[model samples]
Structures are given as C-alpha cells and as structure tokens.
Target chain A: MNIYLRLVYRNLRANLDRASLFFELIFPLFFIFVQGFGLNGIVPPFEIGNGRVISYSLFLAAGAVTLTVINGGTNAGTQLWFDRKNGMFEQILMGPFTRAQYILSIIFATLIIGVAGSLLVFLFAFPVLGASFNPSLSGVLTIAAALFLGTVFFGAFAIALSVALKSSETFQIVSTFAFFIFLFTSSVFFPATSAPSAIQVASLANPLTYTTDIFRAGLFDAMTPTVSLELGILALEAVVMFAIAVIVFHRIRV
Target chain B: MGVNQLSRLYGDKPAVDRVSFDVERSEVFGFLGPNGAGKTTTIKMLTTLLQPTSGGANVLGFDLKTEGRKIRERIGVVQQQDSFDQGLNVETSLDIYGLIWNVPRTERKTRIEEVIARFGMEEFRKMPTVDLSAGQRRRVQVAREFIHDMDLLFLDEPTVGLDPIVRRALLDYLKERVHKGLTIFFTTHILEEAEYLCDRIAVINQGRIVQIDTPENLKRRFGSARAVEFKLLQGSSEALASALSSSADVTRLVQDSGTGAYRVTTTRPESVIPEIYRLAERHAVTVSSIYIAETTLEDAFIHMVTDDENGRETERGLG
Candidate 1:
C-alpha cells in the first residue's frame, strides 16, 4: 500500500493495455502454435528407429512459458528506453519512488503477463502430448517455479538494458541481439542431447536451456535427471541474475 | 529538503552551476529562464533524476543523494514533454497512475473523475491519448500530477503550446493546489506566467541564476527606474541638459522631441524633477504635460539577461 508499491502497480497495469502488451503476451503463444501444431510436417530432428512419428508441437508447448519470461525482460526493457527517449522517463523520475521500485514494478508486471501466456501453453501441452507423464503434482509445481524463475531473470535483463540504454534505437538493437542469444543457443526449440557437442556444453551453461530442460522433464518421463536438481540450478541462476539487475538498477542516474 | 546549490556538468562546463533555493510549506516558486538555461537540470536534481556534481539538495528534508525514495513518495512531477502511453484512453491513464500508488478501488473512480473535471479532460476520458489534440494531451500530462496527494509538485514547461484559455485554467489549478498547501516549483520561458504566478522567481542563463527576486524587485534592480517625460511650452535642450547634468544618479538623458521637451531616464527622479522645475522656471519655459513612468519586469529581464550589459554576449550570440 506504500507509494512505491502503488507506483509499481500502476505502471504495470498501464502496460497491460498497450500494443506491446498484446504482442508480449501473444508472441510466446505464437511460438507455441507454430512449434507445436504447425511444425508437425517438418522432417528434421526425426529419429525413426522407435517406430513412432513424434509431434514436436507438444514439446514446444512445454517451453512456451519460459520463452515468454525472457521476452518479458527484453520487451519491458526496450519500452523503458523508448519512454526515456520520449522524455516520459523524466516524469517518472520526478515522482516519489526509488529506481528499485520502478524496476521491480516492471519485473512483477511481466511475471503476471508471462504466467498468463504460460498457463495457456500448459493446457495446450496436455491434450497434444497425450496426458500426464506421472511427474506428479510436485513435478508440475516444480516446472511452474522454474518458468517463473526464468521469467524473472529475463525481466531483470530487460530492466538493466532499459536503464543503461539512453536511446530507443540502442535499446532495440540490444533487445534484438539479446533475444537471439537467448534463442537457438538455448535448448528451447532443440533437444540438448542431440545438439552439436560444442552447443550441448554451452546449452548446459545457458539459464534458458536449464529452464526449458526442467519444464520438458516435467512433461516427458524420458528425462534422465530428477526434477529437484534442475530446479536448484534454475533458482540459482534466477537469484544471481536478479541480484545483478538490482545492483545495475541502483547504479542508474535516475 | 531545500535545494542547496545543486548543479550538473557535461565533461568541463557546468550545465547548472552552484544554484540554491528553498521551498517552504506552500509556496509557488517559478524558475524563469530561456532554453538550456539549467532550469530542467535543476529540476532533475531536485527530483533525484540526476546527481549533482558539486552541491546537493534535499526533498521534504530527505537527502537527495541517499534518500531519493522518501523524496519520490512525497512529490509529484510533470515533465516538459508529454510521456503518457499513447495506447491508453484518458480514463485508463488516470487509473494506471492511481494504481502506481496502490489507491483503493472505491476511491480511484472518484479521484479519476475529479481529476478529469479539474483538468477539463472529462470529454476525452475514453479517447485514446494518440487521438487527442496537443493541448488535450498536455492537459492529461498535467492531470497525472493530481492522482493523489503529495507535499510538493514540480512542473517543467507545463503549459507549452497551450492556448491562453487552457493555460490560464492550468495556472489557476496550480494556484488552487498551492493554496491547498502544496509546494509547487514550475519552470517557464513566458515572463507573464512567472510574473503572474510565481511567488518568487529565479532567472537562469547559461546554467547559472543571474538574479532571484520578485518581478517588481527585479524591475527595480535592472530597469531604468523613474522615466520623466515633459512637454515643454518653450523649453530648450541646453537649459534642461545643464540643469540635469549635475545629478550623478541619472543613467541617461534624451532631448530628441525637437518640441523643447525631454524624456529623462534616471534612478534618482526626486532630484531630477526638482532640477527640471527650477530650470524651466529660470528659463521662463512654460511646462505643458509632465508624467513619470515606472519600470516593468519585461524591461528588467531585457536589461539584465538580453543585454548581458550590451544585450549581446558569448552565451547568447547565436541564440
């Protein structure tokens, strides 16, 4: 109920109705639809010895929520830079809230929007992927937590960029660059097991890869490692990224 | 907290030099300066947007360097440029601002309507900001400052491009807010806005405050003071010049009417007037019409700022 918290709340709420708002919310869903159902006819990544034609669509759905989290950071951070360029940043700076509050507000708002998109992905995953894989309620909860962590981590990434990039053009370039780094390199759209030996090691090192692997493990019984250890790794990455973001935010001029 | 000589610099030159000012309980302080005069720079420091290079200030007694959050909580700011989300309607914009402070649902609706009415944006409540006119959008931007109560408000060029009617309304609203016990700091290029609205003003040029005073006091300080114009029945330049030449306080004298009258410019009018009377009577010149004129703020501003002693200086060469 304090002004700082209230300010954060108001900022996020306004973001909900923006054009970027719908795009941030729906972009992940699009990724899910294309990767899930639309990609059924693609021939690559096909290991046919098992006598089964697999649908990667369901597998893609499992990663939707986590992808949205990363997008949240990039989109929100880019928008912040745009606002600053337009002089709107000065208006917020003149208000009675700390920079930390401003950053936290964006992160929290993105989390909500991220979750909404992810929940839709979760429901879609169940029907297309052929029901529960016995990961249990705890496993399901574990995946949700991982997705949330990934979302927060990326959201922080965006805030950091927004604070650092003074110009809207610079922000766009950085966000675009960061998104590519997040995609292809991560295990979101590809199986970590089969990626190039070099990329496999990098994927393991990537936070998004861990998030996708953690969620994929919950959806498919084929995952080798237990969900607990994967959850630990995701949480650690989230904490480190989040702390760095806060420090970066505190260092900003406004 | 009072702003204590807060300033900024770009590499070598100071964007704002050691500038100091204090706001008490409910005063409306106007910062009058031309473009790039450190008006925005000073406000940025006060609002904790930019850190000071040499001197620092406080807000509501909170140290700007260390306690920015405390300051941010107790003040409202309207920047020089409009920054509202173009995607949102007027009604939604207020709701979002209110939500930022976490106002309760019941109070938010009423507050939104009240602010809309106060800012005269009721008709545009459901209209997207992108669709509104420049003046309407500006009204929304200013209206954002009123979503909730705050101890102080900072307005940076709040009425730019606004017509006289809307500008007056905005000024009146600001006055009302100050009357309700809110300390308001506003910046303007328009001298009339400062003259009519500001309780006290600080005029800055090239990142430094050249003068700070009431408009009247500034006029007196820089203006030509008493202006004596006389219609001589049969006066001569030699007689008037000789009579007024002995006065040390007179700035200048012009005897160009050719009708035997003089327009005397002086600070010591009391002495000059008597000299003029005696000179006229001694010369037997009949005095027709004589009147003394006072100085104005515009004249004072032109004298001190525009002139820079001669009205053209390095700082204003191209501007």
Candidate 2:
C-alpha cells in the first residue's frame, strides 16, 4: 500500500478507537432529522431567485449536509493537534515520509470523513423528509464533485488554522466560532433573501453559502441562481486554501 | 557516522556547540551529559530533525542537509519522549509502524510477533497503548522500531522508566543486534549502562565535548585520583587529619564518626600511603588495615563536569 494511504488508514482507525462514529456519522443525521421533521410543519416554502418553491425541510436537509462537510474539515485539525501533543508529528517527520506526504494524508483522511458524513446525512434525511430524492448519474457526479471540492476547501482552511495557531484550545475556539458564524450567516438554515440585509451581504461572501447552494442544485434538482458561478468560486477558493495549507505546513517548525 | 563541528543555536545561545565525533560501523557510541547539555540537540542534528546552525555531518555516506531524506530512509530512531499513537493497540501500533516503513504484510506479521515475544509484550499486545504502564509503553516504543531494517539506530534514553532486569535485557538485545551490524548512537545519563554497553563514551558539558575515550581509558585518564581509607588505633584523628591535609598529594581528609576511620582523597595515592604510615609512626599510633579505592566512572563524570563548570565561572569572573 502507499505510505500516505497507510497513514490515512491509521488516522481513521485511531479515530474509531476514540468513538468518533457518533460525532462524524450520527450527529449530523440527528440534525437532519430534527431540522427535517421539526421545521417541516411550521416553516413555509422557501422561494429561490429563479421563482421556484422548495420545501423548507429539503432546504434545511441540504443545510445539514453542508454542516456535516464543514464539521468534517475540523477533523484534520483535531487529529493534527493530537499528533502534535503525543509526539507523532515529530516522529513521523523523522521517518522516510516527507512533509508534503504528511499533509496529503491529513487532507485525504479528512476528505473521506467529509464525504461519508455528508452521505449519511443525505441518506437519513430522505426517510424523515419524505421528499423525492433519487437523482440521475449526472446529478450524483455533481454532488460528488461539490462535496470533494468543498471538503478540500474547508479541510485546507482548518489544517492551516491548526498549523498556524499550534494550540488545540485556541484552534477549537477559533474554528468553532468560524464554523457557527459561517454556517448561520449563510443560506444553510434559511434563504439569504429572508435574512437581514447585513447578513445577505455576509452570506453572499461566505463560501458555505456557495457550497450549500451548489449542493441544493446538484442533489435535490432545486433551481438556484448562478450555479456555474458558485462552483467556479468554490473551486477557486479550494485551490487557494489548499495551496496555502501546503505551503504553511511545509514551513512549520518540526 | 561522521560529525565535524556540528552546531545548533537557539537564539543567541548555542545549544550544541561545535561538536565533532565519529563512530565506526556497528559500534555503540554513547553520548553522556547532564540535562540541557546539548546531547539531544546533537542527536537531533545527526538524525536530520534539526538543521545545524554551522558545520556539517554525514550519516550512512549521505550529507546531513542535502540528503536528509535518504538518511532518514536508512536509519531508525527511538526518541526520549513517549511518542506512541495512544489510540492504537500494541499489535496495531507495531503493525502500522512497519507499514509506514513499507514493510510487506507477511514480513510485518512475522516481525511483530517476534518483537512482541522478545519484549515480553504478549500480555498487553491487545491492550490500548494509553492503558499500559510507563515501562510497558517504553518497551513497545523500543520494540516497534526493530520491525523495519535499518543500518543505524538512534536511541535517546530508551531505558528511562524500565526496571533493571528489563533494561539489561534490552541492552543485551541491542548488543546482539550490534553484532549483526547495527551501529547504535545511544544517549543516556546512566553511567553504568554506558560503561557496560558503549564501545566508546563521550562526556559532554555545557554544549561542548569534554572527553571521548573507551570506558577504561576514560576512567584511567580522568580517574587518577584515589581514596585512601584507614582506621587509627590510638592517636587524635584531628591531628592526623590536619597533618595529612598538609601533604601536596592529599586534596581532602575526613574522619567517619561511626567507624573512627579516615578517608583521605589524593591525586598521588602512593605518596599519601607512605606519608600516612610515617605520620602514624611519629604520632605513636598503630595503623589498622588500609587500602586504596579505585575511582568509578560516576566520580570521574562528576569531576569532569564540575571542573568544566568551575573553569567557566572563573573565566567569567576574570572577564
């Protein structure tokens, strides 16, 4: 097996020992159920810019998937922090592996968690929401692409934060603040039009907004404005964040 | 391995000063020093974990700076810190480490079993690393490195929390591997371990190499002083001690209150012995049994480190 893949396997196995099955796989499913069931009754239909009405439960389920992927990004930082504290960071660097290989392992491992977690949310949300969810091959491909790109963007962002901050406590505080703010201020919970004007502008600039928008269009066949533009911006942000993460990780003191 | 003037500085202070040393293949080169004396810094430089501020080295015929990866590929390291992945069990930790080194599955399995038996890890092989005792954890750390083959191994205080039996077992195990052509760069503050295992020992102090030689040679060169102990029969030990203290060879003299025996430390044991007999004869006191005690490596280490510290202090005072 490739060394990077072996490292990823080890990382995933380590997380298994820590009982992360709940947080990574089940917690997001819980959110999906609560949002899909609890909000479906009282919440009204959400209207997109294209003048198409989508159920509030479907919209919130998409948001829940976004939350799952974004939460997956923080796993890389948490794992890296554990490695740092336990001395595996220095030990692995002293091995035959290069720094780039180490960073790639973290990225791939977190990417797997992101995709798998989001898939779990999507699967569980379908039963509770009772919505039409089956899609064509192209739709599945689009969802995969969006999830991959979004995972890379958020995973790189979190990896950079962990490396630069170098403290688990500070990283947790900063990442939690960023995760809540970005998720709430975007179109994850509600449409940007219904939010305050200040938040509309904030959601316009938030990457999560573009990611959730892309997911909504790809997974549920919901019509949203400027799908192509959102994807292009998401791809650009991923490349930039990933490049910054690699460079910053390479320069970090062993 | 060859190191010439290797140095690593932290801010303005040189943690490892211009240190130069060499170790022939298969030799256990012991690095001895007090805490923060740059022993670990030098090891890190040699292992390519830290970039040297000045000078250079070669490990397995690879340049320290340009060929670090090649060197890393050929060497193994057991660091001073407890560094196992706590989430892994003993078997999985060893298996994963072997896999990281790209060991084949069949071979990894064989080596894992062999090391588990060799290190007495059978009882805890299925236990999580976090639950093991410190010694058991250290055994796992040391045993896991042997799964993959390497020409050189760097062990930084590998026996910190081990019992004496386990420590000796590990030393013997390492000695066997050395016979099979493994060059070991070992660092420890345990003088006895160095004396027993090291082919040559280097005593370091304040970021500098103070002395390097075989254990016997080191003891001989720096251990010239001896302790001459005896009991006086019928004379005032105070007068005898004062008289012996006056001699040029005697550096110190003290009488034991319980035994009424005096131990006189001297650089010239032969001269001190005769002077003691002459003094006993003149004082009209009978001499009891007397013998010269050999200086141990611990004594020599203390003497060398303290002497270096005092020299530095005097130099600073002069400046």
Candidate 3:
C-alpha cells in the first residue's frame, strides 16, 4: 500500500472511537431529527427563488449535512494537534513519510470522512423528508461539488488554525467561537434573504453561506446563476486556504 | 554510518557542535553524555528528524540532506519522548506501527506476539495505551520498533523507566541483534550500561567529543589510579595518615572522619599495602580490613568531564 493511504487508514482507524462516532454522526443526527422536526411547525416554507418551494425541515437537513462536514474538517485539523502533543508527529516524520505526505494524508482523510458523514446524514434524513424529495442528475452533481469544496475549505482553514495556535486550550476556544460565527452568519437554519441587512452582509461573506446555498439549490432543483458564482468563489477560497495550510504546516518543527 | 562535522544550531547557539564519529556494521556504538550534551540533537540529525545548520552526514549509504527518505526507510529510531496511539490497545498500536513500516501481515503478527512475550506486555496487551503506567508505555514504545526490518537502530535512553530485569533484557536483546549483523547507535546516561553493551564508547560534553575509545581503554586511560583503603581496629590512625601521605607512590590520601578508615590513592597498591601494615603496627593500631578498589567507568567519566571543564576554564583565564 502507498504510504499516504496507510496513514489515512491509520487516521480513520484511530478516530473510530465512541466519542468521535457520537460527535460526527449522532450529534448531527440530533439536529436533523430533533431540531428539524421541532422547527417544522413554527417555521414557514421558503420560496427558493426558482419557482420552487422547500419546507423548513428540508432546509434544516441541508444545514445538518453542512454541520457534519464542518465537524469533519475540524476533526482533521485537531488530529494534528493531538498527534503533536502525544509525540506521534515526530514519530511519524521519523518514519518513511515527508511533511507534505503527512499533511496530504490528513486532508484526504478529512475528505473521506466529510463525504461519508454527509451521505449518512442524507440517508437518515430521507425517511423523514422523503415525501417532498425530488432528485435530478445535475442536482446531485451540485450537492457533491458543494460538499467537496466545503470540506476542502474548512479542513484547510482549521488546519491553518491548528498550526498557528500554540496551545490546545486556545485552539478549542477559538475554534468553538469560529464555528458559532460560521454557523449563525450563514443560511444554515434561516434564509439570508429574510435575515436583517447586517446579517445578510455577514452571510454573503461567509463560505458556509455559499456552501449551504449551493446545497439548498441542489436539494430543491433550484440552481441559479448566483449558485454557480458561489461555487466558483468557494473553489477559490478552498485553494487559498489549502495553500496557507501547507505553508504553515511545512514550517512546524519536529 | 559516518558523521562529519555534524552540527545543529538553535539560533546563535549550537546544540550539536562540529563533532564527528563512525559506527562499523554490527557494532553497538554507545554515545554517553550528560544532560544537554547534544546526544539527542546528534541522534535527531542522524535520524533525519532535524536539519543540521552546517555540516554533513551519510547514514546507511544515503546522504542525510538529499536522501532523507531513503535513509528513513531503512533505519529505525526509538526517540526519548513517549509516543503511542493513546486510544489504541497495545496489540493494535504495535500492529499499526508494523503496517506503517509495510511489514507483511503474517510477519507482523508473529513479531507482535514475540515482542509482547519478550517484553512481558502480555497482561496488558488488550489494555488501552492511555491507561498504562509510564514504564509500560515506554516498553510498548520501544517494543513497537522491532516489528519491522532495519539495518541500524538508534535508541535514545530507552531504558530510562524500565526495571533492572527489563533493562537487562533489552540490553541482551540488542546484543543478540548486533551479533546477527544489525548495527546499533545507542545513547544513555547510564555509564554501566554503556560499559557493558557498547563496543566503543564516545563521551560527549558541552557539544564536543571529549574522548572516544573502547570501554576497557577508556577506563585504563583516565582511571589509572587505584584506591587503597584500610580501617584501624584499636588505636587512632593519626600516626598512620602522616606516614601514608609521606610515601612517594601514594598520590592522595584522606582519612574518614566517622569510620576512622584511611583511603590512599596510589599508582602502586602492592607497595602501599605493605607500608600501611608496617605503619599501623608501628602506631599500635591493628588493621581490621583492607582492600584495593579497581577503577570503574563512572569514575573515569567523572574524571574526564571534570578535567575537560577545568582545562576550558584555564584556557578562558589565559585568553
């Protein structure tokens, strides 16, 4: 087996514990099941701007998937921090791996976990929201692209954060604050179109907003020129964040 | 393996100065040094973990700077830090390490069982590494390195937390491996271990090589003086101390305040022992016990380091 693949396997196997399973799978499932179902009665249906309408439950389902991918990215970056603390970072570097190979393995592992978690969320949400679901080939492609680019962006962002921070407590505090900012400012729960002007501006600047918008457009077969533009910007953000991550990670001492 | 003027600098200060050495195939070369004497720094550079500021090394036929991957693929390093997958059990951690080295499945399993039994880790094989004691964790960290094949192994203070039996077992295991054509570059603060296991020992101090020779040669070179000690039975040894100090063969003499035993450091113990008996009889003090103590590696190491420090200080004073 290739060294990168072996490292990816090691990462996946090492993280298959109960806490990781609950946070990566069960936590997001709660939002889809409890939050989505509870909010279905109070929140009205959304006019998704393409002559298509989506229930609040379906919108929350997309947000739940986005949350899973975000957690996966954070997990990917924090794994590096924990490995450094436990001395495995130097240990692996002393083995048959270069720095670039090690970082790439983590990024690739994040991608796998992100995609898998998103699919698992969709699978579990299908029974609850299957009545209003409509599928198309182009729609599925858009969702796949959104998930891929979103995972890359957030994974690189969190990795850069992890490498830049000196202590685990600071990383935890900052990442939690950053996650809340990303979650609330974006169109994950409520549409940015209906939100206040200041929030709308913040939502427009958030990558999560683009990810959630692209996901919603795909889920409701409401792809628009704006969604395409968001996809392009998300790709650019992913590229820049990944470059920063590589540069910062390369400078880390053994 | 050969190192030529290998040096690593932390900012303006050098952690490992321009020190050079070589290890022949199947040789257990011991690197003995005090704390912060650049042993770990040298090992890091040799193992390709840290880049040298200035200098070069060729390890296992690969250039240290250009072919680090090749060197890493062929060599194993047991670092001083404790490293293991905290969430994994002992068996899983060892198995995963073997997989990382690309060991074959059958061989990995065989080696895992062999090392577990050899290291007495069977009782905790299924326990998580996070819950193990420090000694148990260190044992696993060292044992996991043996699951793969390598030409040379670098062990940095691997026996720091092990018991006497386990420490001896690890030393014997390294000896057996060296006998089968595996070269080992070992570093430890324990001089006795170096004396017993190292074919040739290098004493590094203040980032420089002070001395390098076989264990026997080192002891002989820096530890030529023998200690002659005699305890008086009845009378005071005040008369005997004056007589022993006047002898030409005796270089230094000290009388114990509590035990009333007089110790004499001399070049010739045969001549000094007879003189001590004659002097004790002359003083009406009967000799109760007497013995000539041989020099040890620890004694030689202390003498060498202290002499090196004093020499440097004198040079500074002259400058």
Candidate 4:
C-alpha cells in the first residue's frame, strides 16, 4: 500500500472510538430529527430562493449534513494535537513518511469521514422529511463539490489552528468556540437572508454559509448564478486554508 | 555508520557538540551518559527525527542530510518517550505500527505474535494501551518496534520502567538479533547493562564524547586504582587516614564518618594493606575486616565524568 493510504487507514482505525462515532454520526442525526422536527411548527417554511418553499425540517436536514462534515473535519484535524501529545507525530515522521504525506493523510481521512457521515445523515433525513432523492448531473456535481470543498476547508482550518496553538487545552477551547460561531452565524439552521445586516455580513464571511447554500441549491434543484459564486468562494477558501495548514505544519518541530 | 563533527544547537547553545563516532555492523554500540548528556539528542539526529545544525553523518552508506528518507527506510528507532495509539489495544497498536512500516498483513501477524510472546504481553495484549500500567505500556512500545524489520536499531533507554527479569530478557533478545547481523545503537544509564551487552561503549558528557572504548578497557584505563576499605575495631579512623595519606601507593584516602571506616584508593592494594597493618600494630590498634574493591564500568564512568568536570572548571578558573 502507499504510505499516504496506510497513514489514512491508521488515522481512521485509531479514531474508531465511541466519542468520535457519536459526535460524527449520531450528533448530527439528533439535530436532523429531533431539533428539525421540533422547530418545524415554530419556524415557518423557509424560501431557499427560486420559489421552492420547504419545511424547516427539510431545511435543517441539509444543515445537519453540513454540520456533520464540519465535525468530521474538525475531529480529523484536532487529532494532530493528540498525536503530538502521544509522541506518534515524531514517531511517524521517523518512519518512511514526509511531512506532506502525514498532513495530507489527515486531510484525506477527514474527507472520507465527512462524505460518509453526510450521506448517512441524508439517508436518515429522507424518511422524516419525505424528501425526494433525484438530481441532474450538474446538481450531483454541485453537491459533491460542496461536500469536498467544505470538508477540506474546515479540515485545513482546524489543522492550522492545531499547529499554531501552543497547548491542547487552548486548541480545544478555541476550536469549540469557533465551531459554535460558525454554526450560529451560517445559514445552517435558519435563513441568513432574513437575519439582521450584521449577521448577514458575518454569514457572508463564513465558509460554512457558502457550503450550506451550495448544498441547499443542489438538493432543491435551485441552481442559480449566486450558487456558482458561492462555490467559487468556497473553493478559494479551501485552497488558501490548505496552504496555510501546510505552511504552519511545516513550521512545527517534530 | 559514521558521524563526523555532528552537532545540534538550540539557539546559541550546543546540545550535541561536535561528537564523532562509528558503529560497525552486527555490533551493539552503547552510548552511556548522565542526564541531559546529549545521548538522546545524538540518537534523534542519527535516526533522522532531528536535523543537525552543522557537520555531517553517513548512515548505512547514505548521506544524513540528503538521504534521510532512505536511511529511515532501513533503520528503526525506539525513542525515550512513549508513543502509541492510546485508543487501540496492544495488538491493534502493534499491527497498525507494522502497517505504517508497510509490513505485509500475514507477516505482521506473525511478528506481532512473536513479539507478544517474547515480551510477555499475552495477559494484556487485548487491553487498551491507555489502561495498561507504565511498565506494560513501555513493553508494548518496545514490542511494537519489532513488528517491522530494520538493518540498524536505535534504542534510547529502552529498558526503563522494566523489571530485572524483563530487562535481562530484552538485552538477551537484542544480543540474539545482533548475532544475526543486526546492528544496535543503544543508550542507557545502566552501567551493568552496558557492560553485559555493548561490544564497545561511548561515554558522552556536556555534549562531547569523553571516552569511547570497550567496557573492560575503559575500566582498566580510568579505574585502574583499586579501593581498599577497612574498619578499625580498636583504632581510631583518624590515625589510619593520617598514616595512609603519606604512602606513595595511596593516591586518595577518605574516612566514612557514619561507618568509621577508612577507604583508600591506591595503585597497589597489596602494598597498602600490609602497610596499614604495620601502622595499626605500631599504634596499638586492631584492624577488623578489610577488602579490596573491584573496579567496574560504573566506577570508570564516574571517574571520567568527574575528571572532565574538573578540567572544565580549571579552564574556567584560569580564563
């Protein structure tokens, strides 16, 4: 096997714990089912643009998948801090592996988990929301692109933070705080178009908003010129974040 | 393997200062040093886990700076720190480590079983690594390294946290591997271990190689003087200390305040003992038990390090 693939397998296998499983798989399901249904009656139907009205439950289903991807990416990246604490970072580097291979393995592992968890959430929400599973080739491409770019963006962002932070406690606190800020400010749970001007600006700056918007556009067959712009911005952020992660990771000692 | 004038500097301070040494094939080369003595730093540089600030090294015919990956492909290092997948069980941790080294699945299984039984990890092999005791965790860390094959192995204090039986067993296992053409770079604070396993030993102090020779040769060179210790039954230790202080053979004489025994370091214990007995008779004092202590590697290491410190202090004073 290739060294990168082997490292990816190691990362996946090492993280098959209950905590990772629950947060990556089950926590998103809770949001999709319990919170999505509970908010269905309280919040009115959301117009995702293109005159396609959908229940709050259906709207949150897409957000749930987005949240799952974010969680997967964050978990994958934070694993570096744990590896450093446990000494595996230096140990693996001592083996037949370069620094790039090691960092890429974590990114790829996050992609795998993110995509898999997103699919599981989508499948679970299908029955509850009574949503149809039909899409054109372009729509499928848009969804795939959104998932890929979203995962890479968050994974790289978390990795950069993990490397730049001096201690694990600070990493955890900052990552958790960042996760909540990203969750509430984005259009994951509610429509950003109806929010106040300041929140709208914050949502526009958040990559999660772009991911959720692109995913919602693809799922509802609402392809518009704005979705393309969102996709382009998400792709650019992913590239820049990945570059930053690589630069920060290289600066780490052992 | 050859290292020439290799050094690693932390800012302006040199952690390993221009240390040079060669390790031959199928030999257990021991690196013995006190705490903070650059043994770990040297091992890290040789194993490619750390980069040297200056000078050069050639490991297994490959340049250290340009061919680190090639060198890493053939060498295994057991670092001083514990490393493992804490969430994984002992078996899985070993298997994953083998996989990372690109070991074949069937061969990995075989090696895992062999190391498990060899290291006596059967009882806790199924338990998570985080749940194991310190000694057990250290055992797993050492055993996992054997899952992959390497030409040269670097062990930095590998016997720490192990019991006497396990430590001996590990040394014997390394000896077996060495006999089968595996070269070992071993570091340890245990003098007896160095004496029993190392074909040649290097004593490093203050980031420099103080001495490098076989265990027996080091003892012969630096610890040639035998120590004669005797307790006075009827005589005062002060009298014996004063009488032995004038003898040409007696280079060092000190009295133990707690035990009231006199210890004399001399070039010839045979001459010093009889002289002490004659002195005791003249003083109307009786000599109780008396014995000559053998010079060991520990004694030699202490003497060499102490001598190096004194030399440095004298240089500083003169400067």
Candidate number with greatest DockQ:
4
Q: Whose TM-score is higher: candidate 3's or candidate 4's?
A: 4
Per-residue C-alpha lDDT of model 3 across residues B1-319, encoded as one tens digit per residue: 9899998899898888899998999999999888999999999999888999989999999999999999999888898998988769999999998998899899999999999999999999999999999999999999999999999999999998999999999999899989998999999988899988999998898888999999999989988666788887874566778877999888778777888777777768889999988988788889999998777787678767767887889999999
Each prediction's interface RMSD?
2.9, 1.6, 1.4, 1.4
A168-254 per-residue lDDT for model 2 (tens digits)? 899999999988898888888888878999999999878888888888877776545588888888899899999999989877786
**Model 4: per-residue lDDT, tens digit, A10-36?**
988875455766667888788888998
- For model 1, the docking class works out as acceptable
True-contact fraction in model 1 equals: 0.71
Q: Assess the local accuracy of residue B19 in candidate 4 as a C-alpha lDDT between 0 and 100.
A: 94
Q: Model 3's DockQ?
A: 0.57
Q: How much is B26 displaced in model 2, in angstroms?
A: 0.7
Runs in model 1 lying further than 4 Å from the true structure: A2-8, A17-57, A221-229, A251-254, B103-107, B225-294, B306-319
Q: How many clashing residue pairs appear in each of the predictions shown? A: 14, 0, 0, 0
Candidate 4 lDDT, tens digit per residue, B1-319?
Answer: 9999999999999999999999999989999988999999999999888889998999999999999999999999888998888779999999999999999999999999999999999999899988998889999988888899899999999999999999999999999999899999999988999999999999999999999999999999987667888988963656666877998887677777788888777668899999999988887788998999888787678778877887999999999
lDDT of 2 at A249: 82
Candidate 3's displacement at residue B164, Å, is: 0.9
Tens digits of per-residue lDDT for model 2, B177-217? 99999999999989899999999999899899999999888
Off by over 4 Å in 3: A131-134, B225-292
Q: How accurate is candidate 4 locally (lDDT)?
A: 0.89
Q: What's the CA RMSD of model 4 in angstroms?
A: 4.4
Candidate achieving higher TM-score, 2 or 3: 3
Provide TM-scores for the models. 0.79, 0.88, 0.88, 0.90
Determine the TM-score of chain B of model 1: 0.75
